[model samples]
Target chain A: MFPTPVEKRSRAAQITYQSLVPLALILWLLPLIAVALFSIRPGVDFANGNYWGVPSSFELFTNYGRVFFESDMPRYLWNSVLITVPTVIGAVALSCMTGFALGIYRFRGNLLIFFMFIAGNFVPFQILMVPVRDLTVDVGLYNTKMGLVLFHIAFQTGFCTLFMRNFIRALPYELIEAARVEGVKEWRIFWYIVLPLMKPAIAALSVLVFTFIWNDYFWAVVLTQGPDAQPVTAGITSFNSQFVAQYHLMSAGSIVAALPPVLMFFLMQRHFIAGLTLGAVK
Target chain B: MTLPTDPPTQTWLQRHRMIITPLMFLLPGVAFFAVYVISPILQSFYISTFEWTGLGSLSEQGEFIGMQNYRELMSDRNFEVSLWNNVKWLVLYLLAIPGGLFIALFLNQTVAGIRVYKSLFFFPFVISQVVVGLVFSWFYLPNVGLLNVVLGWFGSEVNILGNPDLATYGIIAAGLWPQTAYCMILYLTGLNAVDPEQIEAARLDGAKGVRMLWHVILPQLRPATFIAFVVTIIGALRSFDLISVMTNGGPFGSTRVLSFYMFEKALSEYGFRMGYGSAIAVILFLIMLIFISYFLWTMWRDERAARL
Candidate 1:
């Protein structure tokens, strides 16, 4: 809006702007477009040095079938689902209560506790890598999906709590006050009043945390090793190594690895954007 | 009105509900956070003082060689390269802010299919960085790679990731793909919330193009810009996945940022020197702490303003 609408410009200018938009988008997404192209080409295309030519034959089904059936990709994808879903549920449930507590109540250390979560969320993962891995190993959860899930739930709660608390703070205070005046129990107030209103936030966070945990490669690499517990992001590396130089297969594998979060984003675009742009609009 | 509420079990909960309710709610989250997030930070600092291969128990295997690892970091050439690359990353990665703003301004329209276009435009940010790295590596692949084929039209070519001098820049370019998209979405959202009346007023005074953007538009976009800046900086520092997948700190280890370097020094491939890795991690932590403190300070100020 600040740049003035293209409709306000000359007819030629409007047409030019419209044409340029797609051109710019194509250029911006060229690399991904190439991969999308690569994923569908026959395995012989790379060996034939026909990288950019139109695919002689579509091997979308064949390549993807190999990824799914001939490899550990399914195991890794399952591991990712296993790791991500629990983290989303655990983090969201924990943060809902924490957010309610921090947002609704006025008490000493409230701001301090909130800031601690804030600070912890921003600390680089490298710092946490050694100790968190050690902690997981010592607890005998090492190399297990449960280990990864538990760490994720804890680490993600930091950000989730920050988001939830701010969202809870924005809710009407009068509703809570009225409930208090009615002598309703605090837990019931949270359940019947606050929890119902937190639906949008919860939905937004679930999609967000799903993408985050699903795409997580660092902790997956550190806490787990084999396909037994490794998520797809890390598993994709082994997938690449296994099908080394088989561009079609590797491209297919990469797309498969990156699919869930991309699907999540497209389906939940509104909530995903809302969750991401939380503080952007003031 | 109070008579029906005087149940026997209601005495304690009613008397101190405010204090107790919050405490009850906070315990699980805090306990988990403390064990997983907080205490480990302290433990890392302690671990940095000892030499251990990350085998056996820490108390028995670790020899307390205080400050030796830090001393080694001072002379370590790989550490030096990694540190410089991180500086380069911090500087170059910020270009995404302006790049995103340019695209966001271009796309902030009501044209037909614009929503689909915007989503397609933002597609990169949603995909995992690992995939992005793999995609870019293929894009930069020598001989028959897309880049070389394109460059052949001009009869000029260069191997990007295979060259030591250019490899870090190549990886940074790949990272900017998604980072710019992220910033673009933020700016688009910010632009939606911009005041039309203010824009009209500025137009009346004959401000358009860069003048209007500099004077009227950007001031209103401060919140979005702050978020963009914070995320870009953080993302720049947390750039392990791209390096790992693309070059694996290759072309003579020229692409190692501190994050990747720490992992290389401390864990996989290299034998585990937990002490050395923790030392490197501590430095990265300290560097990040500077920005984290500033971010918290700004957020705290906003919180106070909102509370009052």
Candidate 2:
């Protein structure tokens, strides 16, 4: 609206705008398109430097089969799922209760607590690296999926609390007040009254958190030792190093590693964008 | 102002008892913050003073070295290089904003498959950075790479990733894929909320092209710009994955940023120097603190104004 709609522009200008769209999009997504092309090409074609040319043969299934059968990719994929699912459920559940409290109540040090969460959310992971690793070890959760989940849930709560609190704050306060006045009790006010209204926020956070924990490479390396527990993002890096000049297989592995989050984003693109742009427009 | 016909407001507040209500809500979040977030910060600050390598017996005895790590960093050329590269990254990473905005503006047109265009453009962000790194690495592959293939048409045979001068730029380009998508999404949301009447009024006043955008558009895009700026800075500073993937800060450590350097110092086969790594991390933390404080101050002002 601020730039003025294309329909209102001069005919020449509208024509220029329409012509540039595909060219720009092509340039923008060149990397992804190239990779997609590489994934389906036969290995012999990649070796001969005929990568961009038409694949001599489509060996998509064979390449994909090599990735799964020859590698510990299934285990890695399972580990990623094991880590991501728990982190999402734990982080969202914890933040819901915390967000509800911060939004609905006004007590001493409320602002202080809120500011602390905001500040914590921004700090680099390095600052927490040593302590968190040590704590995980002490608890006997190191090198396991549960360790990653616990840390992610604990850390993600900072951002989720901010999101949930801000969302709950924007809701009509009178609804909660009326429920409370009717002797519905504070807990029921949360369960029946407030919880039902947070569907959009919950959906948004779930998709965002799913992508985040799934793609987490840093913690995957630090906490876990090998393919037995490592997530696919970190697994792909190790696999790439081993495969070395096996470019076709490496491309196939990369695509496999990237599939889950891409699927989630496409399926829930709206909620994911909503969650990501939390404070962007506000 | 009309007075409430019911009992005074104090009675209602007393029944709720302001003291207990917020405390109940604040406790779990506060306790979690104290245990996981706040305490670790203090712990890291304390660990920075010691000479401990995370292995072996704690009783193996690491003498307390006060500020030795920071002093070593002062004389360390690699650390200096990494720090300078971080400065470069912070500056160059801002390109995502204008790049994203241009794409958003281009795609803002209503068309037959604009939705597909938006998603495909956003496809980069959905994939992991690891895959992004692999994709770009292939794109920059000397003779077989797409870039080389395209360049070969013009009779240019340059190795972009292997050349030290071009290596950092190549890695930064990979970083931009997701960063640009992120910024484009933010701008799209901001554009959605722009007041329509003002655009019509400006157009009627002979404001078209750059004048319309420069005056009427950019001011309303402030919120999105602020967020873009913050995320870009953080993304630049936090660029460990791509560097690790594309170059591994290699070819004589030309692409080493603070984050990767810290990792090398702490955990690489060259031996674990947790003390030195913590020092580098502390510096990164301080630099980030400047941006974080500015953001917090701005948000506080906005929140306060909203409350009024």
Candidate 3:
């Protein structure tokens, strides 16, 4: 709207703008396009030096089958789900109360506590790595998916609290005050009142936390060692090492590793953007 | 007087409800956060002063080398390179803001199926970085990579990823895919918020094209730009996956960043030097702290002023 719609521009300018869009998108996505192409390429081409040439046949199913049959990819996917779903539920649940307490209750250290969550959200993960790993080992949860999930729920609570607090603060206080005047207990006021109204925030955070934990390569590698506990992202890394230069197979594995989050994003695009653009417009 | 629909007698369970109810809702989450989140931060500070590998008992004998790891890192060349790569990443990664803005402007039109195109354009960000790195690695493969093939048509066959000089940039390019998409979304939201009245006012003043964009649109886009800047900076500094997947600080370790180097020192191919790694982590943490404090300070001041 700011640049004046295409019809407002000259015919030549309109054609140029239209033509540039696809060209730019193609150039922008060249890497993904190439991998998508390669994943379907026949395995025979691996020896023929035809890696870049157009595929002679599509064998994506066979390559995918090999990844499933020969690798621990399924286990990795399950681990990712195990870690991600709990973290999402845990983080969101914790943050909702934290957010409400910080946003609604004008108590001492409220801003300070809010800022703690904010600062905690930004701290480098490395600082947390050594000690977190040590603690996990000490608690006898080392190399277990539970170790990673417990850490994730906590770490993610920082950001999720930041988001939830801001969102809850933006909600009108009058509704809560009106309920309070009726002598409604604060807990019921939250549960029967505020909790149901927070669906949008919960939805946004779910999609966000899902993606963050799913694509979490750093923590996965650091906390978990092998197929027993490794998530898909780390699984893909091992797969890459084992299938080195087996481009088709690697491509197929990459696609599989990337599928769940990509599908989540597409399905929940609105919620994803809503969560991401939290303070962008303000 | 208002009449109650039910008997007003207090039940035995209702006496201390205020204290118990919130506690019941809050206990589990708070316990998880404390055990997993809050305590580890304190422990990291404590662990930074001593030596320990990731396995076995910490009491088994770690030399208490106070600040030696940090002191040693101060003189280490690899640490310096890693630090420099982080600086490079911080700078170049910001290109996503303008890159995204340009794409957002281009696609702001209401062409047929533009919604589909916008989603497709944003596809890169939705996928995991592991996949993006793998894709780009193929795109930059020595002979058969599509990038080299495209360059071949122009009579040049350069192996971007194989060259130590260009490998970091190659990975950075891959990183830009998602980063640019993120920025595009921010700008799209900003564009939606731009006041039509101001643009109509500017158009009446004969402002158009670059002049309009510079004078009218950009100022309105300030909030989005700031968010874009913050996310881009944080994302750049936090870059680990793409580098790990694409180059692994390879071709003579030209692509090492502080984060990756910290992981390498703490865990992977390099031996587990937990104390040394924590020391490096401290340095990275301190660097990030500078930005974090600045962001918090600015936001704090803004929030306070807004309340006034």
Index of the highest-DockQ prediction: 1
Q: Share of real interface contacts recovered by each model?
A: 0.81, 0.60, 0.64
Q: List the residue pairs that clash in candidate 3.
A: none
What are the models' TM-scores?
Answer: 0.98, 0.95, 0.94
- Colliding residue pairs in candidate 1: none
lDDT tens digits, residue span B12-67, model 3: 65755554555555566557666666676677766778887866766666777888
Better of 1 and 2 by TM-score: 1
What's candidate 3's i-RMS value?
Answer: 2.6
Per-model chain B TM-scores are: 0.96, 0.92, 0.90
Best by TM-score: 1
The TM-score obtained for chain B of candidate 2 when compared with the true chain B: 0.92
lDDT of each: 0.93, 0.84, 0.85
Model 3 DockQ class: medium
Highest lDDT model number:
1
Q: How much is the lDDT of residue B8 in candidate 2?
A: 65
Report fnat, model 1: 0.81
Query: For residues A108-168, could you state the per-residue lDDT of candidate 2 as single tens digits?
Result: 7677777778888888877777777777788888899888888888889999999999999
lDDT of 2 by residue, B50-154 (tens): 687877533364446889988999999999989999998998999999998987887776667778788888888888888899899998888888888899999
Docking outcome class, model 1 = medium
Model 2 segments more than 4 A misplaced = A8-16, B1-18, B56-60
